[model samples]
Each structure stands twice: as C-alpha cells, then as structure tokens.
Target: MLSSLLTKFLLLSCVNHCALAALNGHCPPLGPVLPAPTQPSKHGAVSAAATTLKGIINKTTAAYNSSAVAIGVKSIHESGFVFSYTYTPPDKDEIGTQAVDLDTVFRIGSVSKLFAPLALLKLGISLDEPITKYVPELRALKSQAREDSPVWAVEWDDVTLGSLASHMSGIPSDLITDMAPLGNLSAYGYPAANSSELLSCSGFFGTPSCNRTAFFANFGKRPPAQVPFSAQTVYSNVAFAILSFAVETIAKQPFADYVGKEIWKRTNMARTFATQPNASLAFIPVDDIWWPADLGFEGPGGGYFSTINDLHRLGDAILKHKLLSPVRTRKWMKPVTSTSSTGVLIGQPWEILRAENVTSDGRMIELYTKRGEIISYYSTFALIPDYDLVITILVAGPGTPGEVTGASMDLMMSQVVKTLLPAVEKAGKTEAKAAYAGIYVDQRTNSTITLFLDDKDDDDNDGPGFSISRYVIRGVDVPTTDPGGTTLPASAPPALDPPMRYRLYPASATTMTRTSGSGLEQGLQQRQQISWRAVGTRSRGADEVAARDAQFAWPMYSCVTWATMDRVTFGFGARDHFVFNLEDGGRAMAVEAVGYKVRMERMSPS
Candidate 1:
C-alpha cells in the first residue's frame, strides 16, 4: 500500500499544464487521507534538518526584528510530507511550542476563504449566484425605517459568489465597528441593523437575545427583489460570513462540518480542521486576548490548523486536482476581476500574479507564490511549478517593533526567493565588472587626477591593468577641474614637483606599489623602493620645506605622485589624501590613505 501510494504521488508531482489536464476528473482513490509523515527513526538526520531550518528562521526573524517565526516546505516527489521549522525570540513566551503539529488547530484567518469558494463550487452554485437567494436578511436590512440609511439602500442582490470570492462585492473591508455594539443581537436586530445596538439586541425567535429570530422577522417584513450591482474590489469579512451562513442554509449542515466532510476529509487532509483546538489537543495560549472567543470557533474566515506535512499535501492535492474537478479548480485560481496596470487581482484569498523574473545570462523563469500574515503570526507558501518545489513559512509572536506590519516578511521572502530559486535555472553567469574609469577632482587642491586603464610593462600583469596619472592644475586641459590650484609654491619644478604627483603601480592584482619624486629618474627609483607603509603623519612636508626657506616667502615643495595598474584614482592635498579603489571582479577593494580612513563603494554594472 505504501509503495502504491508513493507511486501515485510520484506520478502526481509534476505540475505542468499537461499534468493538470490529465487530472481533469481524477481524484486520489477514496480512503483516509494519509497521516502526517512519520518522524524519522534516525534522530540525527531529523535534528540536523530541524536545527538548520530553525537557524534559518531565527536569522530571518532577527533580520526583520520579528519576535518569532515558523517555516515549512515539502518536496512532493522526494519528501511526500512537509518539514517544519520555527523560531521564537527571547522576550516572548506566549505558551506555545514553536513547532506546531500539522494537525494542531489555529486561526487560519482569511485562509478560510479557500474552503468557502470550494463549498460554493461543489454545490453547483455558479459564481454568479445572487447572494440574496441564499441570505434574504440583506434585503430586509435595505428596508430600515432610519432616514440615515441610503435613500436607495444597496445590497448584494446582484453580487455573485464569484465577486465575493474575489473581493469585488462592494462591501466594506470590515463591518466590525458597525456591528460590535450589537454583540449577539447585531445579526438579528432590525434585520437591517447598520449600528452596533441592533446587532446586540436581536436574536433567533424564542431564545434569550435571539438575534436570528428578530433578523428573520425583520427580513420577512421587508419585500425582496434584485438590486443594482456595483462592482469594485473590497475586502470584507462580513461578506464571507454571510456566504458561510448561506452555504449552511442550503446544505442543511454547519459550515465547518460541511467543509470538513466534503472537502478536507475527501482530499485526505487528515491534519486539517475548521475549528479551534479543544481540551484534548495541546494549544499554545495566545497572550493578547483581543480576539473574541467566538471568532476562533467560527471557521469561515479565520479558523484552521495543520502541520507542515498536511500543508504540503494540500499543495499537492491542489496541484493534482484531487479535490475539486480541474475545470472548477482552475476557475477558483483564475482572476475573476481585471486589474488595472498598477493593480493586482485577488483570486480568493490568494493574489493572482506572475512571479518576479531574474535576469541572468539572458533567460527568464517564473515562480507563482502566495503569502499570508495575521497579527503576530506570518506565513508564506510559494509554488515553483517548473521546479516542482513548494516553500512555506509561518511565524508566530510579535513581528518587527512599532506598527505590526508585513513589510518585514515581504523583505525576508524577497531575499529568500532571490537567493534560492535562480541558482537552479542557470549557473556560472559571472557578474559584470565594476566601472572605475573616471577623473576625480579634489575641490581643495584644484588638481585633477586621471584614472586610466594601466598599460605599464610591469611583471604583475595578473592585477587590474589600470593606473592613475597625477596632472598639475596647469598641465591638463580638462573640464570640471577644481578652481583652487595646489598649495605648493609656484617655484616648484613643473615636471615632477608641480602641485601634486603620486603614481600607484600595481605589483599584483592585490598589492600596490607607489613612487613619488621630483623630476629625477634616480630619485624616482629610490622613492619607489622606499617601503611606504600606511601610517598617520601630522606634518604635510610643506612645514619642513617652509622651515628651510627662511626668507618667509611661500615654501616650494614637490608634489607626490602614485600610479596603480589596478583601477584607482589617487589624490593628495595639504590636509588629506584619498585613493579611489576599484577591481574588475565586481567587488569593492579598499581605498587607503596615509592619515585618513579608507572607504569603498560597490559598483553595479550599468
């Protein structure tokens, strides 16, 4: 049986369009969904994989300043189950293990929409089914006596299940503020309660605070008919809740139980659930109690839990069309609404879009992905179809400090994708070389230094073939030269003693030799041989020359010249000297000076 299961899984692992077409009416043979992958009997390998993945999560969390993080991934062909990893920062202890069982229950938040759309699809409910047919309360709410109600109250009479699934129902992102005060009565009150009080006071007939009864009474009192439809992308939890209620009315079963029996169980998602963890199961206590206790039990918008193994199974099942028929599954994944050039379409809770492309060796590859985040927990599930790879990451506890946001997760996922995916596509595409060719002018010296491709007949040919030419203010005919000439006296030798002269010659790609002299070849050789170590010298050498010229006129001093075959520009002034270093390997080599600190800038190819 195990061999047969593995064979079926291996056949289903390929995710091409052809594979999807092949699975048009196919479902995995009906049986109990396989259990979560058993723990490896060899503890060493399991611990090593866990430890490595944990370290990765910890590093990513720290980089994002997140308090905790969890991640899981599965290879459909090789692993056949999800491997999970998690991390929690030092400051938080919210009563839960970082490692959650695949079967463990937690609020899936908006992920619950995944099941709602599936349920509607299974009932042969067209995406265009008018919401009013299932939930007549919306019509009753439209007939409120309150003048504040829109003179022409808008309802979901024309909106379809499709629109709600894709967030185009024109409903507000949240009705919580409008519904909060009504508490249990809100849904039943006036049947059209737009305020908190109505929701709190109304309930089903014959029960204390029976909002459902009041809601139905009010609903029956009002006439029902289709209303005008206005379509726009609007995220609304209320819409999904209403839809879940509609599914229950039609299917004659609780929303959670219906979804579990028909969808999750049939798909063999044994670890999946549509409810909160009961006393029998271990639950990590959440520190913040802001969430309503009832909300956790309601499974439409935000309630479910599963181990990494189950998630991978879910990914595989979706890819293989084991639950919904291929035609319906494709519809669920398709973008129902057109997005503007700048806008993105929301397919169910997943954002439907193309993956980012990396330019390498002039080739492109696509990676389809979906990411999730809620309160303190963050999650990501990426599917690289061509590579047959699925990556999922979940995080718990506080994310980066200040405003709780998904920007940290976005940054981390971007980096991970950039680093991991492209390597599989192509290899050995060298990065472009750094462009270091330029003339840098020192504003203080009014001198220009030209950094040129070095062509000197030096034995160190392995180094970058670049050198710097020190030009006096008068010698070079260049634009954008510094206006102030060198601080050296006008009497200095024009050839080598003019304002500044420093030549840096590359002894090798990594080592540099510099020579400085005043117009004499012998002096050049002597200076070149001098071991000029990087040091801190206070005197500018101008002081010594000035002391020798006791007549009190300006001192005549020789300029310093250095040359490098490596791409670098050298500049020296009374107060400071700078070396602009560059290498051909697209890496930044350091710029060194005698008294000042060195700085480097990594250059990118244009």
Candidate 2:
C-alpha cells in the first residue's frame, strides 16, 4: 500500500533555452550550468495553506519519535509568496535534522522522474518514437519474465518513448529476484533494494553505469519482464533507467550533465544540484532514528536535490509555457492512460490521480502529483491547475507506521483543498464578474475577437447577475477539408463563410463553459465537440493605481485553449485565448493573446 502511494507521487517540470526555443523552432545546445540566484527575503508570507500544514504537522508530530520537521510552500499565482521553515530537534543529533529553509536542497527521490521527460522533450524527441531508436540494445530483452517461456521474443521496438515515460512500457514493475508470481509483486517489486542499491552498478543493474556494452551483455542473457506493446501500465524504474541511458547516449554526456545544461542553468536554479552536494544535509532514517546519510547514484528514476523556490520557479516556467511550447506542455500533461484500477491517469513522468472518495457535494478531486520517498526523505510536488496553485512538500524522518517515512502529504493536500475550495473562496468574494466583458482582438495575428454579454434577459434565472457570453473569432476561415484529405482548390480561401461563434454558459460568476459547434468547419456529419472553461476575471496590486483611478482594475485573464491535442479530436486546430487589459469600467484598452498583444478600441454603441 505504501508502494502504491510512492508510485502515485512522481511528477514533471521545465527546462532552460525556453525563450530561445520559443523564438526558434528547436532547443539550442545548452551552455555551462550557472548557480541559483539569490532569493529576496519573504518568508513571512506563507499562505493559509502553510498554516494548515503547520497545524497538521504540529499536532501529528506528537506521535513521532522526534518532533523536528521541515516544510516548504509557495503560492505564486494569486498571492506571490514563498515560505519555507525548518525545525531542529532540541537534541539535534537525535533527529539529525538540519536548519534549512525552502532553498535547502534534499533528495527528491522519484520526483526526478519529472525531470527526465523534460530533458528528453528538450531534445525534440517524439514521445511516440520507439525506444529502440535510441537504445537498440533493448532488443535483447524479450517477452519472457522467466527463462523457460516457449513464446518467440518480441521486438523492443514495440515499446514507445511515451510508454516508458508514462510507465506503460510493459516492463516488469521491478526486477525479479527469485522467480515469484506476478501476484506477489508487492513482495518483490521494483527498486527491490534500498536507495543505496537502486542505481548500484554492482547490485541490480549488473552493468557499469552508462555503459551500454556492459548493460546489453547482461540484458541479452536474461528473460524479459513483460510482453512489449502491452497497454497495461507497469511502473518500471528500469524503463526510466533505459530512458536515461538513451538520452545520455544520444547527447554524448551524462544524464545529470545534460539536465544541468538544459534546465537548472537556464532557469537560474543555482542550488538545485543533480547530486546531494552537502552530505551533512542528508539524513539516514531507520525506525525512530535519523542519522547522517547517503542515498545513491544519480539516475533517471530519482536523483535530484532542489529547494522550494527553485522548484516553484521551475513550475512557473512550465505553466507560463516559458520552458516549453504551450502545445508540447499540454501534450505532456494530457492523460497517457485510460482509467486504471487505482483511478489514475498517467502523464509523462507524472500521474493525474482521480481520487475515488468524493467531497461533501460529490466533487471528485483530480490531483496532479509527483511524489517521492526513500529511506530518509519523502516529498510531494503537485499542480492543482484548476486552482492555479502548485504545492511542494519535502520531509525527512523515521519510518513511522501507517504513512510512509512519517509523512501525511495526501492528508495535507486534502485538508488544504477542502479549506480553500470554491465555496470557501466565494464566501469571501467581494467583486462581481459584470466588469469582465468586452471586445478584444489580437493585432499581431490580425485576429479580431469579441466577448459580449448575451442579454437574453431571463429574470427566471436563480441568482442576481449571471449572464451568458458569446466568444466569436470573426473573419476566421477555418479550413473545410482535412489536411490529409483532398486538397483545397487555389480559390478556396475566398469561399469561407460565417465566423465561428461559441456560447459560454456561466459555470461561475467569472467562469463560463463553452458550448459550441464542434470545429469551425462543419464538413463532417460527426462533428467532434470541443470543451473550454473561460474565465474573464482580474485582481489588482502590481500597484499601478492612481488617486484619479476610481476603479480598482486589472488584466482579465483566461486560457481558452488549454489543450492542443483536442485539435486532433475536433478536426481543425484553431484555439485562441486572451488576457484583456481594461479601461476604468472594464471597457477594453488592449489585450495580449497567444504570442503577442492586440490593441482593442471600444466601438460607440450603435
């Protein structure tokens, strides 16, 4: 069960060369890795979420062998604050705890899986490409978990790069020691050894580190763990190891070196080292005692040490599409699996968990998390995208009962979400969404769009002032024929008709659910519908207010197209979003959409 929790936690993040990549079509070769930047002093601003964490830990530590704990929380979206706290035991030697803040680095364990995919994606490698293209030696691994299976060996090409990243590679969850039944997987599962032995070339791998020659020699002689091309997700550390190996082989450098060049250096994550630089900071955990420690070698599965601020910077970069293109970022977050028994959907190097338990109102919680735990440390890095929030927690302690490594990250998450749910938020809301409507346009693309209130004036509607809004991308000539189908005639451009209009029903005061004709072009009878949640809301305090400014106005933000893969589902690729900056009374000034800003001038009422 603890293993299940561990499998549920690993997640992903960003890289450097982000701006360069956005400008150019490819990620350039990275230069020397630089040090992390100095963070401004702002420790007192820990959000209410931190308060919940402190309360929980303060109460829960009563059951622990030692009361020392370290916590980190950053709420950058709405409230720009970074908070980190470290607790040292009265008898410091007993817990072996260090006085470290959010910037203090610790072993991230499986959270390192998140970085692997980012590194791989930075190389512009297709997730659908077969692993054999990078590591052909994998062909040596066959379909047999044991040596005596009579079936012919399946080619390694059957496994794609995405499968390995998402744990759908069909590789055995772990290496088999003594020919046991798959049902006994819990007993002899992956990384079957402790952290020390996980990446030990002399132990499980039976090959020299980064040496394909040694690896293939050992791999060819053994039976495969599972059949290739199988859809069943079997979380495999070996698969990640192979991915690491392939990335290194392709880059002609070590995995850590490549990541440092591509990610940390680029993002100014100065202290986020590939290895634990200060040995004194690491602790060895047993039942109730934590001594000075050593984890293991850097690998694709888990081998990173990062501070709270650095991790937050990484998440922010990914969210803003600064590290990767919005399209790739969306694809990276898209579900790689259908619903599994655990109600989990695997994404690249991470898992989007659909919690089985429901809130009081039957609201299902979908948690996007990357969790990690080893002998001495446990961490949970999560993105609650719906709330525009990211939570990162790292704690080290004794092997307490029930929770793994004496950490209640899941409970901590649940408590935070429940306390800050929309209901709680609305109870405190003072502003209305009436001031968020206006006509906006993207001048850079010559794309004109309008967001007008649908005054179908229905007094029968429940609450005070919720109204439907229509978003129309006018002058759009959404292509009729599929790109792969019959070619459009040279004169087809002029034949386009009416603009695509979408009706947005109120989901909340500021948010709207898109109900639209599938694709812009209605050529096919089976029109695949598109889904969008639009929010035109704003908040002030970059402090641009003047005494004459009667309205406390801010930029209206919304991401109309959160997913790019939906284009494949909906036939044509035309999704646009905008952040409209308004005049005194929510009248439009200018708006930034997609790549550039568009000036919006209000038209006099006709």
Candidate 3:
C-alpha cells in the first residue's frame, strides 16, 4: 500500500485548474504573513561541498599571485556548519613569510566603515541629527569658508549622520593626498612645496604629517565634490573620519575604545582592532611603497585588522541579532537610497546587490555586502539574509596587475553564493517536508487531501510550492472531476474524469486564540495560523503554449499567474487559502481550507 501511494505521488503533477474551483469557492482569513525561514542544516554534505570549493579557491588565489588569503563561511541557523580556508604563496621571501591561518590577522581596509554606523546605532544616536552637532570642527570649517565660495561648498549644518554613513554627504573623497606618490612638481606645471595652492601635508613617509590640528586647519579650503544633501553617493574616506570624530565626541571616549567596548568585545571579535595589531600575529604584506601606515584621523575609515575567525564571529553576531534589537537590525539592513542601477542599492555602509537566478524558481535575493581595498590588501563580505549565510574573503600581497585580486574576490563570491543558496533551499524544503507533508482529512465531510514537497530533479515537474498529491471533496475526486465551469454546491456531486494539478505556496503565519470550548479547553489556546496560496495549472500541451505565446508580443501575457495569485477574495477572506494550525517545532496538527469552509485534522503518521 505504501509503495502504491509513493508511485501515485511520483506520477501526479498536483491539482489542475478544475480542482481549484472546488477548493477555493469561499474565502480565507486575512492575517499577517511573514517570510519563511531557510532552515539550514548541519549536514556533512555542505562541509564536503565546501572542501571541494576550497580547492577551486586555492587555485584562484594562487593564480592571482596573492601572498596569502583567508576566507570564512558561517551558517547563522545551523551550528557546526563553520567553514574556513587559508592559502599562502609558495614563493619564499627575505622578510620571512609566515604561514597564514584563520587566526592570522590582516588589514581589513575600508571594511572598517561597518563599525562607525553600528557604534552610533548602539548609542541610540539619531542618524537624522546633523553631524555638526557633535563634530564642531565641521561647523568651524563651514563658517571659515569664504562668502564667495563655489556653490558646491559643503553645507555642514545640513549634513546628517545618516547621510555620511550612507555616502550621501557630498563631501570630498579625500582630505589629504599624502598617500599619493611623490613626483616632480615643476614638470607637472609649477607648484612649489611652499605654495598655498598645495597642501602643506605633502611628501611620503612623514607626509600624513598633518595632525588633527593641521588637518582641520587646511580642510576648509578644499572644494567639496557636491553641495550637501545632493543625491550623490560619493565614496568619501573623509566622511567616515568626520563620523568617527562625532562618534567619539558623543560617546565621550575615543572611537576605537568605544567600539572595542561596545562592538568588538560584545561580538567576541577579539582579534579585530581599530588599529594594526602586533606584527607577530598579522600578515603585513612586504610592500615598501604602501606598507602598513597609520591612517591617522582616517583610522576609523580603513585601518582595522582582523582574523577570519573574528569576522565569522562578527557576522554571526549581526545575523543572530545579538548586536541590536530585531526591529533596529531590520531597519539597519535596508537600503538608505537606491542607486542608478536597478540591481544595486546603498545602505549605511552596504553595497546591496540584487542577485537573480540563484534559485530554481528564479527568485531575486538581496545581498547586503561590503568591499574594501587598501594598497596591497583586499577584502569583501556578503550577508545573505534570505539564506542565513555569510561569506568573507580577505587577500593580501603586492597589488596584482589587471586587478586580479578583485576578480578573484568576485569569483569566490559568485561561485559560493550560487552553490550554497540552492543547497540551503533544498535543506529548507527537506525540513518542510518532514514537518508538513502529510494526509489531512475531514472525516465528517468525507474530504481528504495529500500534500508533499516535490523532490524531483526536473524543475518542469511542478511549481516552486507544495504539491497536492491527492485531493478529494465530499467523496468526489476533485482533481479528476471536471465541473466544466458549472458551480457545484458543497454537497453536490460531479463524476470523476481526467486529473489536474495544483500547488500551495506559503503566505503568512500568526498566533491566534481558539474560541471553541469552555474553561481550560478555551484558555486562550495559542496556535500558529499559516496561510498557503493554492495555485493550479492549465492542462495545456507545450505546442499550444508556444503558439499562444508567439501571438502575444508582451511577455507578461505568458506570466499572468501572479495577477490572480493573492488578489482574489471572497466573502470571508482570500480565495484558495489554507490555514494550518501549527504546534511547536512548526509541526502542523490540523489545517483549515477557509475558502472551502472545511476543517481537517492531520491523519495519523504512516
């Protein structure tokens, strides 16, 4: 009997368009809907995949001629799913190359931008507040500007902490060019070192020679990239520097000290520091021209060094919402402004990328990501909220030609996300099947339905939802019953015919009270109510579908399923909705087909 049931499931598509009318005649309740969790599993398969992926990474890192690379992957929902890979160049050097590992620290460069906003968020500082309120030096700079200065002069009073963090402050990208290579001034057309047209903080070595006093003294004279509050996302290292100063002033502690106590310490990122750590523990690339130099005021912008293990901890902390309240974290993760590209968005310090075709159903996934580079080092990390996944890549060596380091980072990101997202989706489906795939029956009404997740390798077998393997209503096989557009009453009968297909997608889940029984039985019985959207397919052949599509010039004509997906409504609620009463561990005890006005209890385990 079990083998026969399995064979029936294998042969079926789902419920067809004809069966939908029988199931969706009434209305379903309108309750809150939430995103389904991507239940990541702690399975050996992922680890084995990672092991294979690491080999590809090793070849790519070596091909880029990187001195060393460290990468880490963590699953937020699943314990024992941490993965790390390290690669060191085969060539030896006179400076003595130390073998790098997960614990060996590397300069994370501009990735430090992440900490400034996090610290301010922790302090309960209003992001909309003008930055000048805390960084009075900015106010001084605005006041000192000439009355006849260009219209692009930054309006410090109008710039807010939010704007700075989101790279919309319209400030200059750099305050000093000390990092720029020194060259003959006369050959480039005439600026002597003493000329006021040139910044006094010139020359390499002692060049960033500009202290806080000299930095602010000469900063006012520099022209702004755009007027304050302009709809421009200018990548400004100086903006983060100014934001750090504001943070320090408000927290009444140095920026580094504040973050150390509030962020790094709390997140257990022990190896992550605002300044370069001890050389013995760090992988300082051998580069005389752009060696590890103190960023001075810009330390908060791009000076932190961290190990792979610390980054994993930080990512885990952010995903688990251990660093901020759930509400605030959600707010923080969203885009502050949209960019010119449809697939790109700008958040506080995030470069949000909208990835497509990562799943079998072609759903878009938004990745909250950050990239950093400083001379010889490169770093990037992407946090995928949909999959509860985090991936970090750090590279250090002499800068490679053709920007190979960047290409290597992109390769790692695209490949890992492509591989892991589907794995995570499959894992979530596996978990869902165990919890929800079963027979539900209303014995009194003689209605029964069998639901199961399609684990078939062929994507064309069904839609990206739970398949209705078997469905019957009032002793009538609904899938096989062809009403031929005739509205049959709940108690009416229709002869069984050819079968059709249907699938159910999750809509919402909420806790509600059962007001049925009395006393203890009705004591505010809390059960999770989950609504599913039932969708049915037309039994059309591929040749007919192709002919119909060829006639319509518009592409949406071929994709009108979404038009009636959740829009249809009846007297009580949404049509084709099923509300499942869930127990702990997300197990469904019973289900109610609201549109059908029928409640069914879960059948006993097979």
What is the lDDT, from 0 to 100, of the residue 348 in candidate 1? 63
lDDT of 3 by residue, 318-361 (tens): 87789988778878998988877777899998999886456654
- Candidate ranking (TM-score, best to worst): 3, 2, 1
Error of 2 at 401 (Å): 3.5
For candidate 1, the lDDT comes to: 0.44
> What TM-score do all the candidates reach, one by one?
0.51, 0.59, 0.77
Off by over 4 Å in 2: 1-53, 82-97, 141-154, 175-214, 220-225, 282-298, 355-365, 402-407, 421-606
Residue 249, candidate 2: how far off, in angstroms?
A: 2.4
Global lDDT for candidate 2?
0.48
| Candidate 1 deviant stretches above 4 angstroms | 1-56, 63-66, 80-84, 90-95, 98-105, 145-152, 179-231, 279-286, 290-292, 296-298, 338-343, 359-373, 381-388, 399-405, 424-606
**lDDT head-to-head 1 vs 3, winner:** 3
**Number of the top-ranking candidate, with lDDT as the measure:** 3
Write down the worst ten-residue block by lDDT for model 3: 25-34
Residue pairs of candidate 3 with colliding backbone atoms: 14-501, 14-502, 15-500, 15-501, 15-502, 16-500, 16-501
Residue 43 CA error for candidate 3 (Å)? 4.3
Model 2 worst lDDT window (10 residues): 28-37
Write one digit per residue (lDDT tens) for candidate 1, span 1-606: 235555345334422212112112111111111111122212244345445545665565565332445455554445543245554445533444543444443334555566777788788788688888887666666555343233334454766776676767665443222444434564465354345333433112221332234444333222222133344465555556667877888899988888888877876777666644542332233453312233422346554555455566667776556777766766666555555532255676566544423322111233344555456544566664443456665445444364225776666556555544344222111111123334544444344544443234532211212233433343442222322233443453343322232323222112234444556764354211111111111122322322323222321212112221112223432222444444433232333332223232322221
Residue-level lDDT tens digits of model 2 in 98-134? 4556665666767878877888888888989898998
Give residue 594's lDDT in candidate 1 (0 to 100).
24
Better of 1 and 3 by TM-score: 3
